[model samples]
Target chain A: EPEVTQTPSHQVTQMGQEVILRCVPISNHLYFYWYRQILGQKVEFLVSFYNNEISEKSEIFDDQFSVERPDGSNFTLKIRSTKLEDSAMYFCASRGDTEFFHFGNGTRLTVT
Target chain B: AQSVTQLDSHVSVSEGTPVLLRCNYSSSYSPSLFWYVQHPNKGLQLLLKYTSAATLVKGINGFEAEFKKSETSFHLTKPSAHMSDAAEYFCVVSGPTGFQKLVFGTGTRLLVSP
Candidate 1:
């Protein structure tokens, strides 16, 4: 089965540094999403993208966060400035005609 | 709008024993409920989902969930447990419409002991 793939399984960056997490969604998927899971916390939604524009975003997706579909296959989430609290597992997901989503393995971001 | 709640924070069961992970949901519409499992250092894997179809939904890896509308619950169960079954399970809910905007539960950590 085709699946979503993420690069840089683990990322370590100092506080105040910029970080970009990359994902290659399923080829045919039309919608994309970004979610994060803090250690010992629930998975939290950040943003959703369709047609190269953000559809919706949660409060957790603040000024420091941005998403881009730079190419037809690659979707990325960039954090302008990493904070200690930003340490979490970031998951990328894609959706097609159905509402079901295929999630990537996730990028573990450790902002120290 | 939709939300999910995983009742237990942790559940331990011996191998060859039955397993149960409780979950409850609240949705303005007929919610689409799902159970996802995450092993240590691994990504989330879909176990099963209920999209207003048969209440009893069977998923991969010997796992299953029953969506009880009356109880607003979709609890995951397995007849026999294996060491590989140790993982964190998340219950998720999404509104009937939209781009699969999901609300996830805090998750239940299942520990299978041999």
Candidate 2:
């Protein structure tokens, strides 16, 4: 079966540096989403995208965060400036509709 | 708005024993419910989903869930637990209305003991 794939399985960056996490969603999937999980915490939704625009976002998705589908297959999440709290497992998920969702292995972001 | 609550933060079961994870949901409209499992350092894997279909939905890994509208619950159950069943499970809900944004529960960690 086709699966969502993410690049840079793990990343380490300086506290004030910018970071980009990339994902290639399943082919033919229309909706894409980004979520994060702090160590030992529940996964929190960050944002959702459809038609190359953001559909909804959570409070955590502040000005520092932005998502782009620069190409047909790649969906990326960019953090303008990384904070210590931004260190977490960021996951990319895709779904054609409500019935099923496919998630990528996730990119572990570590900011020091 | 739609939300899901997983009753137990952790559950321990012996191998071959039955498994049950409880979940309750609050939704203003008919809801779409799903159960997902995540192993260490892995991504979320969809186990099953309920979308106004039959109340009893069967999913992968010998798992099943019953959607009880009267109780506003969608509980996951398995006839027997295996060692590989040890993982974190999340309960999620989505509103039937357009936008279909998913809201996830805190999660339930299952530990299958030998």
Candidate 3:
């Protein structure tokens, strides 16, 4: 079965550095999303994208954050300035006009 | 607004015993519920979903969940537990109110011991 794939299973960066997390959603899917789970905390929604634009975003997804399809199959999340609090497991998900969302294994981001 | 509550944060059962994970939901309209499991350092895997289908929904790994509108609950269960069943389970709800955005619960961690 085709599944969403994320790169850099783990990342380490210094505070104030820029980082871009990459994801390849399932082919033919129409919607994409970004969520994160802080260690020992509940998963929180970050942003949702459709039609090559952001459809909705949570307060956590501030100006420091942005998402882009960039290409037909690649979905990327960029954080302009990483903070210590940005450390978490970032997950990418996709769906096709359905409530069912397939999630990627996740990228563990650690900022010093 | 839509939300789900996982009653128990953790549950322990011996191998071959029964397993139960409780969940409660609140929604203004008809809601869709789902059960997702995540092993340590793994992604969330959908176990089953209740989209106003049969009241009792069976899923992979011999697991099932019941949607009870009267009780506003959708609890997951299995007759016998296997060591592999140990994982963190999340109850999620989505409604038209939020463009089908899923609201996840805190999650319940099940431990199956021998």
Candidate 4:
């Protein structure tokens, strides 16, 4: 089956550096989303995108965070200034008309 | 708002034995419930989902979940546990409307032993 794919399975960056996590959602999917799971914590929603604009975002998605669909296929989450608390496994998901969301393996971001 | 609670952090079952993972949900309206499994280094896979259609929802890999509105629960069950069933299970909930953001439970780690 076709699936969502994420690049740079693991990323390590300095605390003040900028980092971008990339995802290629299923080709035909419409809605795109980003969620994060801190170690030992519940998965938290970051943002949702449709039609190249953000539909909704959580409080966790603050000024430092931004999402872009630079190309029709690539969805990216960029952090302007990484913080230690930003370290987590970031999952990208997309769904078609169906309610089910298909997720990528996830990008493990380690801010040090 | 919608939320899901997975009762157990971990559950262990022997091969050929039944497997049960408890989950409860809180939703302001009729919620869409789901169970997803994540194996090591793998992406989240939808095991099953409960919309308004049927109370009993059957999923892949011999897994099923029952939606009990009164109990506010959607617990996952399997008649027989297999070694391959070991993984992290997440109970998820979404709003009644179409395609809402999914709220996930902390998750239950299933360990199937020989």
TM-score values for chain B across all models: 0.97, 0.97, 0.97, 0.97
lDDT of 1 by residue, A56-85 (tens): 999999999999999899999999999999
Can you write out model 3's per-residue Cα lDDT over B2-106, one digit (the tens) per residue?
Answer: 899999999999999999999999999999999999999999999999999799999999999999999999999999999999999999997673345778899
Q: Which candidate is the best by DockQ?
A: 1
Docking class of 3: medium
Q: Per-residue alpha-carbon lDDT of model 4 for A5-52, expressed as tens digits?
A: 999999999999999999999999999999999987788999999888
Over A16-63, each residue of candidate 2 has an lDDT whose tens digit, in order, gives: 999999999998989999999999999899999999899999999999
Report how far off residue B73 is in candidate 1 (Å): 0.6
Distance from true location, Cα of A65 in model 2, Å:
0.4
Give each candidate's fraction of reference contacts reproduced.
Answer: 0.87, 0.71, 0.48, 0.74
lDDT of 1 by residue, B1-114 (tens): 678888999999999999999999998779889999999999999999999889999999999999999999999999999999999999999866766698899999999898
lDDT of 3 by residue, A1-112 (tens): 9999999899999999999999999999998999999988788889999898888899999999999999999999999999999999999999987888999999999999
Candidate 4 regions exceeding 4 Å error are: none
Q: Could you tell me the TM-score of candidate 3?
A: 0.98
lDDT tens digits, residue span B1-114, model 2: 889999999999999999999999999988889999999999999999998989999999999999999999999999999999999999999776555677899999999999
DockQ of each: 0.89, 0.80, 0.71, 0.76
